[model samples]
Target: MTPERFAECLASLRWTAIDLTSALQCQLSWIEAMEGGQAEIPEDLARWLESLAKCHEAAGIPSHYRGVAQF
Candidate 1:
């Protein structure tokens, strides 16, 4: 996902970059860089985000981000 998409996703989840990084047990800078597109989305990070979204959905949470179309 694009940085904007990722940022929107975080907002939808009521999570900050620090929260996401803490939740995923990653570095704050790493998460920021990834969302900023200073670094590419690694396979592990991608999978983690996918899993995070799924977990949120399973918990009956709705996505705040509409999609790439609106973006």
Candidate 2:
């Protein structure tokens, strides 16, 4: 996904970069790279986020993760 679309996805999901890094159990730098267009967003991740966004819109997923500390 392009950086713009990736950002849009995050907004749709009500996720900040920190929230996403926490949700995905990934490093913030990786999220940054993806957001900054320095790294190609893996297709699996793009697809995953797309599906997750749909779920989010339906309120199928929790608004935030429980028991996960925010950095």
Candidate 3:
């Protein structure tokens, strides 16, 4: 995903770079770089985001509510 979209996904999940990094066991700089467009988003990170979205859905969080603008 594009950096902007990744950032939006994080916002939708109520997460920051710090949160993602901690959850994914990656460096904060890596998450920041990806979100800032300084580096390409890793495949693992993309998959993690997708999985997290699915989990949220399974938890009954509506898509509309999880959108960036909703919070």
Question: Among these predicted structures, which one has the highest TM-score?
Answer: 2
Instruction: List the candidate 2 regions with Cα displacement exceeding 4 Å.
Output: 57-71
Per-residue lDDT tens digits for candidate 3, residues 1-71, read: 89987977787688988988888898898888998899998788788787876676568655675547743
Q: List the residue pairs that clash in candidate 2.
A: none
The lDDT for every candidate, in the order shown, is 0.76, 0.91, 0.81
Full-model lDDT, candidate 2: 0.91
Ranked by TM-score, the better of candidates 1 and 3 is 3
lDDT of 1: 0.76
Q: Each candidate: RMSD to true structure?
A: 9.1, 7.6, 6.6
**Residue 62 of candidate 1: its Cα lDDT?**
53
Candidate 1 TM-score to native: 0.60
How do these models rank on lDDT, best leading? 2, 3, 1
